[model samples]
Structure formats: structure tokens, C-alpha cells
Target chain A: MVDALSAVFQRPNFLAFVIIFLWGFYIMVTRYNLVKKLVGMYLVQTSVIFFLVSISAKKGATAPILLSTTDPVHAINYVNPLPHVLTLTAIVVGVATLGVGLALCSAIYRRYGSLDEEEILKRLE
Target chain B: MSRHFPAILFLLPLFAAISMPVVCLRHRHWSRPISLAVLSSMVVLSILNLNSIITHGEVRYAFSGWSAPLGIEWVADGLASMILVTLSFLGLLALVFAGPTSPKDLGGRIVHYYTLILLLISALTGIVFAGDLFNLFVFLEVAAIASYALIGVAGGRALFAAFRYLVLGTLGASLYLLGVSYFYAASGTLNMADMAEKLPHLLNSKAVVGGLLFMFIGLGIKMALVPFHAWLPDAYTYAPESISPILASLVTKVALVGWVRIIFWVLGAKVIVNDIPVLLLVGILGTLAAVIGAVLALNQRDIKAMFAYGGISHIGIILIGVSQGNQTGFVGGVFYLLNDAVMQAALFFLAGMAICQYGARTVEDVGRIGKQAPWFTGVLIIVAMGMIGLPPTGGFFGKWYIILGALEANNYIAVAAVLLSTLLTLAYFVRLFEAIFRQTPLPSDRLPSDIPFAYKLSLGATSAAVIMLGVFSDPIVQLLLNHALPPGL
Candidate 1:
């Protein structure tokens, strides 16, 4: 348990990811402005992407690209390419989601003439 | 050509969705027929694919000639093909039912609407066929974006509802992706079958458990299971008339299929049910949703809101079946999934027609519908009866099978909850019936006889199906669902 705790502390990157995710979630839950809520959502998405990317990183590893000069590429010498590829796909999905979200927000704004979530709900009620 | 069935099934609607606007610009009247042609072709392909799966064993198609486990593959075993056929057929019927617009004021947006509808269908098809987790996420986003635009196209409170749905739906998708990342990190593969192979070995790993939890919560929100169901009522109520029926029938149902695949296939039921409390938790949540959804629905004035809440209640029943984790329970759950798709689509189509015919939005307005449009009201009564689980409706058998499964599992609470929700369901739908048949008259719009014939035919077809499905359920149960499900449930 102590070793696990020390390991977690040593890897602050993982801790930061968790904190950022929670913070984004908090904003999404509490914020009344639609734009802010969407921003929170984006933060949450990016944090997950970062966490996934971090899992593929090995200390002192080079980029996934092979160097012919270094002949005979070793697995340990380069970062794993799979997570990068996966996250790249995820990033594109995230951006598409964000674009759609912003478009929806703009539509909401045009209709209600305001972007406050609670205010809109109150009016709807 | 047969080998390319999966690609043809998904790509047809996709290319059609893309070209809809251009087709509309050239000849406006051609857009709807073009969409119908694409969807009809997809239905034919999916049916052929399902037939192949049944006659043979599983049908597996790898994209770009890539091999399995390493390359993405679309495999229709038992379950996936069943859903593929149901979703595509429902989509085709709903598009047909949408009929031609008046071509007056609403003419401009008709092309866009059909485009989004076609895109949504394409996304749903892809979601069901995707063998890789990341591929599922991509399709999920595509579906989400299309639905958002579809909802907002109605242009009023629908915009707000779509926005709210977007926020929650995006959050759900992100959580699901994050969960996939954990699995990928642990198993070094995103293909579902590969993940399943690795999952048993990693049962004790915290990352695996965390991933499961994240996915469960994410999918629950997406499916609008209790406590995460706030957005569904409005989204369903406020969406464009033509779009609601398709979304009602297919969207959440496919999402549930995704959930089942992840829990029972990818993660393994033994790990999910034995190693954790997910089964019990879902069962309890389902019970809560069942009761709460029915009670909330009882108070709703808007017809669509009532159906949306009722949808939540039925989802709970499906959860109970899954929690049982026995063959009978899986069968019951899968059967209920099929029944709900047909019945709910029927109900929503009736609701849309009522709104178009008389601008009927509430129960009071609906009361007048019966006196004016007897044919529409008659068909609606059958759907309502089905919703309330009356005999000779497909719904009754689904509940019957579920009750038997619950009894077999010795989960009396689930059994009791199922029965109680039935009563609650009857209570609410009966109120609608009373308003339709018994209530005093009120002034309402009476649509002219010029109302499109296609709308009535669609409603008639689905209503007839509800009864036929109940009577001829044995063949379907033996053929489609029994084989469709993964073995050893």
C-alpha cells in the first residue's frame, strides 16, 4: 500500500489527469451557462485523451517513427504507436462533438436570447 | 457482392445522406424518394445478411481486407443481425411514413431533415456492426451529431432540448471512450472479442473494474436509465415530428445493445456479475426507474412525454432481465428489446400523426381526435393496449417471458416490480384511453381528408405487426433471438 501510494505520488501526471477530470465534471454539474458547461465537457474529454496518451509513453522513448540510421528498430526505443493513433481518432471525434455542441448552443441562444441553463428552464416551466 | 453486405448496408445510407442536399437542389421532389430507395436497399441487404447468418454460423467481414483481432471486422452472429434487421426495417417504414411535406412553408428544410435522418440511420447501422471499441465511439458521435441537428431543426424549444441532450450525450460518449482507453491499456486491443479474451485474466485489476464502472455509468446515461433520464422526456417531446418516431424506436435500443455487448461479451458476465455488484445495482436501479417512470408518466399532460417516461420504465424491465444473467432472462431481454422498438415506433408515429392532423399536443386535444378521426384513434388504441401489455399484443409476451425469467432467478423483487409497473403502465395509458373515448367533447382542429395516405398505412402496418408478432412469436423466438444472443448466457 505504501509503495502504491509512493508510486502514485511519483507519477503526478496521473494525479493531474484525475484532478482535471473531476474539476471538469464539477463545472459541468454546477455551471448554468451552456457555453461554460460545454467548455467543461471539452476539458473532461481532453483529460481522458491525455491520460490515454500518457499510458503509451515510456521514459526516454523516441517518436514512433523509425530511423534507418539506427537500423533494427527496438520496441522499447520508441513510444507505442497504437495509443497515439487511437487518441488521434478520439481527438477528431471530440472536435466534431464540440462543433455540434457549439452549434446547438448557438441555436439555443438564438431561441431564448440567453444561454443561462436555469433561466431557460425556468422560462420553459 | 454477398461478401460486401456489411459495407453495402452502412455505406448506402451514408452516401445517400451526403448527396441528399445536392439531389434536392437539382430536383426537390426527388429527395424523399431517394432516401426511401437507399433505406429500402439497406433493409434488403440486412435481411439477406441476417439470412446468411442463420443458415450458416456467424458472418464476418473485415474492412480493407484486414485480418481479425488486428484489423476491424463486422461480425453478425445471432444478436447483431437481429437488431440490424429490426433497426433498418423500422427506419425504412418511418421514412415512408414521413411522407411528402406540404411543399409550402416547410419546403426548404425537408432536404436537410431527410439527410439527417439518413445519416442517423447510417450511424446506427455502423454502431451495431462495429467490432472495435473505437469504431463504436466514432459511430456514436456521428449519431449524436445527427440527432442534435435533427432535433434543433424543429426550431423552438426543440433547440433547448437538443442542447441539453447534446451536453449529456457528449459527456456519456466521453466517459465511454475513457473506459475504452482503460481496456485498451490493459488488454492492448480494442476489438471486442479480443478484449473478452483478455478480460478474464485481468478480473482482479483495478483498471478493469474502473473501466467497467465508467462504461456502465456512461451507457446508463446514454440509454436514459433512471437518475440519468432527465433529458429524454424533453428530447423526445420536442423533436421534429418525423424524427421522433425513428429516434424513439432505434436510438436508445441500439445503445442498450451496445451496453449488453460490452458487459456480457467484452467484459464477460462472470466478471461483471460475480466480481462486482453491477448486476444487483442495475437491477435495483431498474426497479427504481420502473416505479418512478410510471408514476411520473401518470402526471404528464403531453402525450409524447408520457411515452418517453414509459420508455424509461420498460428499459428498467430490460435491465432486470439482464441482471438475471440466465438464458431465459437473456431471451426475455432480447425479446423485449425487439418488442419495444416496434411498439414505441408505432406509438410515436401515431402521436406525430395526431399532431399533424389536429395539432393535438395534449390529452384533452386527443379526446376530440377520437370523435373526428375514428380510424386514427382506433389504431392508437391498439398501440396503447400494447403499451399496457394487453393480450395478443407483442408487449404482453415480452412481459410474460420476463416474469418467468424473474421467477426462475428467484428475484421476487424484480418480479414484483415488473408486475407493479404493468399496473402503473395500464393506469397511465388507460387515462389516455379514457380521454380519447369517454371525456366530454372539446373543440379541436379536424384535418381534411387530404391527410397523406402513407401515414395511415405506416400506422396500420406497425399496429398489425404488434398483434402478428404476439401470435407468431414462437418462430421469431426460435430463429432470431435464440441464435442472435451470444451462447452461455
Candidate 2:
């Protein structure tokens, strides 16, 4: 139990993943403001990206870039490049999602003049 | 050229959608024709691909000649090929009906309208055929973004509805990606077939189960399965008339197909049925969705909202077949999905037409205009009977197969739910029919006169196809059975 506790404490990324994900979930479920909900979604997305990127980390690894001097590359000395590549694509999609989401929220605000969920519901009714 | 059918099927629409604005600048009248041409070519390509696949086995096209497992691949397996053909074909019919119906409502933004639609169709095609998890996510986002823009394009309460849908859909996609991250972390691969091969060795891992759960919930939201279906009704109700039929017919089905692909193909059915309790949960959810969807639909004032709830109920029936996880159940599930697309498209198309013609929005508001358009009303009754699973309609064969599958699995709960929901479906649709045919005829000036030739052609084709599918379901059932399970299941 002590060893497991130390292992968990040593990995801050894992803790960050849990905290940020739950925080975003709380915000999304509790906040009724439209823009805030979008922000909460982004927070959740960021947490996932961070978790994915962190998975590639190693204790003593450098970047996966090649050099003339490092022709015989040691696998243990290089971090995985695939997750970073995936995260890049994910980040691009995340930006697109935020842009469209914010546009929709703005459109809603223009018509209803409020971003609160209760207010919007009353107006819709 | 024939070998390039899969790539061109999506790339053509994507390129055309990008150039649609420039085309609009050159000639505004060109948008509709451009969309029609794109959809027509898509239909042809999908049909050709399906035929080739049926004859020559699965068609695997690797991107840029990198080959499978190392680079992106597009696999037109039996399931993917059949659904792609059906989706594009239904999309073409909806496009035909859409053009004459909602030009005034869309203002001058019809170019953007067609652009979003083409993008959506392209994304859906990509999703159906995508062989990698990351590729699926990208295509799913493309579809979601296009739908978000399309839903709110008219700028009214639709904006609010679209916003709500975007929030839910984004979170769902995010959760799914997180699940994909776990899968990737566990197996070190993103190719679905490769993952499936590796997953069984790691079946007992926490990451695999967690990943599957996240994906299931994410896709459940996208498929609008019962509890997560809050955004469907308003979004369908408020969308422009031209857009509703296509969205109603194709979107949720594609999402469900994606979910099934992941569960059966990526995770493998052995894990789902033997190693986990997921099938039981799915069965329970299906039963609940069946009863709840029908009951809620009965209380809906708006015709579109009622159908939206009814769509939920049908989804439940499809789920019953899926949860059975056997050959018979798989056949029923797959067949029901195809039948629902036709039945729902015809119903929505007819509703759009009736609304446009009579200026009616609610169930009660629809007067006895059926007398004015007898042929259209006849098609409506035929499609409605199909939804209620009446004999000699496509819907009956689908439900019958599912019931048989449920019995085989000894899932009496799902069987009871399916039977009860059929009765509920009958109750609501009968109410709609009575409203349509029994109401007093309005003044002569209120009657609709100019039923477009395109509307008549598309609606007639779908209605006739529904009947024909019911009568000649044996061949289709054979086709579904032959390819019901992925290899090694």
C-alpha cells in the first residue's frame, strides 16, 4: 500500500488527469451558462490530450528526432513520437470544435439575449 | 478507376463542397445542381463498390500505398459496403425532395446549405469505411461540425437547439477519444483489426473495460439511445424542412453502426458476451428505451417530435437484436437498421411536404389535406403501417426477425418490450392517420396544388421500396446472415 501510494504520488500527470477530468465534468453538469459549458468541454478535451501525451513520457528519454551522431538509436532513450502526432491532430480538432461551439453559443445569445439555461428554457417555452 | 471508387466516393463530395462557395459566386442557381450531381455520383459509386465487394470480397484500400497496419486504410467489408450504399441512396432521395421544398426558408444561403450537406455525407461515408480509430474520430467530428452548422443555419430557436446538441455531441466525442487513448495505450495500435487481434490477450485489463464503457456511453449519446436522447427532438423539430429528412434518416444510424463496429469488430464479441456484462446492460437499456420512447411519443404535440420519439423506440428494437449477439439477432439488427432508414426517410419527407403545403406544424394542425393529395397520403399510410410493423411492410420482417433472435437468446424482457412497443407505435400512428384522413377538408384556397415532380418521384420510390423490401426480404435476409459476424467471432 505504501509503495502503491508512492507510485501514484510520483505520477503527477495521472493525478492531473483525474482532477482535471472531474473538474470539467462538474463544471459541465453544474454551470448552466452556455459559454461555460463549452469551456468545460474544452477542459475535458484538454485533460484527455494531456493524458495521452503523458503516456509517451519515459524516465530518461529525449525527443524522437534523429541526429547524425545517434545512428544506433536506443529505444529506451527516446520517447514515443506517435502520441505527440496524435495529440497534434486532436488539438486541431479541438480548436475546430471550440470555434463551432462558440459560434452556436453566440447565435443563441443574439436571439435569446441570455446565456443561462433556465432563461433559455423559459424563452423557448 | 473502379478500384478508386472508395476514395472518390468521399473526395468528390469534399472537393465539391469546398468549391461550392466559388460556384455560388459564379452562379447562385448552380448550387442545387451541384449538390444533386455530387449525390448522384456518390450513389453510383457506393452501389458499384457494394456490388464489387459482394462479388470479389472485402476491398481494402490503403492510403498513399502505405499498406495496412502502418498507415490509414479504408475497408469496405460487407456491413460497411451495404450501409454506405443505402445511406448514399437515401441521401440522394432526400436531396431531391429538399431542393423544391425549402428554398424560401434557406434564404440565399443554399450554397452553404449544400456545402454542409455534402461535407456531412462525405464524413458519414468516411465513418462507415474508416479502418482506424483516429480516422473514425476525425470523420465523426467532421460530420458533427457540419451538422451543427446546418442545424442553426436558419438562425432562430434552431440556434439554441444546435448549441445544445453541439455541447452534448462534443462531450460524447471527447469521452470516446479518451477511450481510444486508453485502447491505444493498452495495445499500442490504432488500426481496428490489429487492436481486435491484440485485445483478447488483454481482455481482463481495467483499461480495456473502461475504454469500452466510455466509448459505449459516447456513442449512445450520438445514437440518441433513450437516456442520452434529449437533444434529438428539438434539433429535429427546429431544423429547416429540407434538412430534417436526411438527418432523421441517416445520422443516428451511422453513429450506431460505428458503435457496433467498435464493439463487435474492434473489441470482438467474445469479450462483449463472455468476458463482460455489457450485453445485459444493453438489453436492459433497450427495453427501457422501448417503453419510454413510445409513451413519450404519445404525448408529443408536434408531429416531428412524435416521430423523433418513435425513432427512439425503433432504435430500442434494433438494440434488442444487437444485444442478443447471435447470428439471428445480428441479422435482425442489421435489417432493422436498413428498414428504419427507408421508413423514417419516407415519413419525414411526407411530413416536410405536408407542412410546406398546408402550413401545419403540429399533429392537430394537419387538416384533411390527404383528400387533396391522395397519392402522397397513400404513401404516408404505407410508410406508417411499416413503422407499426404491420404485415406486408418492411417493418414487419425486421421486427419478426428480432423477436426470433430474442427468443433464441431467451431474452423474454426484450421480447415483451418489443411487442408492447409495437402496440404503442400503433396507438400514436393511428392517431396521426385519423388526424390526417378524418378531419374536415379546409377551404379550397388552403389546399396544396403544386406538388413538385421531384417530391412525387422520391417519395414514391421510397414508399414502393418499403413494400418491395417487405415482400422480397428473403434475399436481403440471406445477405445479412452471410456477413452477420466479423471474421473469428
Per-prediction tally of clashes: 2, 0
Interface RMSD of 1: 1.1
Clashing pairs in 2: none
lDDT of 1 at B287: 88
Determine which window of 10 residues in candidate 1 chain B has minimal summed lDDT: B99-108
TM-score for candidate 2, residues paired by index:
0.96
Best by TM-score: 2
Show the lowest summed lDDT stretch of 10 residues, model 2 chain B: B268-277
- State TM-scores per candidate: 0.96, 0.96
Identify the runs in model 1 with alpha carbons over 4 angstroms from their true place: A1-5, A69-71, B100-107, B272-277, B442-450
The CA lDDT at B206 in model 2 is: 79
lDDT of 1 by residue, B276-357 (tens): 5566777798889888888999999999999988888988888887777677777777888888899889988888888876
Cα lDDT tens digits for candidate 2, A10-78: 999999998998999889889999889988889999999999999998888888876558579778888
**lDDT of each residue in B163-265, candidate 2, tens digit only:** 8898899888888898999889899999998988898888777788888888888888988999999999999888888888889889998998898888788
Once model 2 is optimally superposed onto the true structure by TM-score, how far is the C-alpha of residue B433 displaced, in angstroms?
1.6
TM-score of chain B of each: 0.96, 0.97
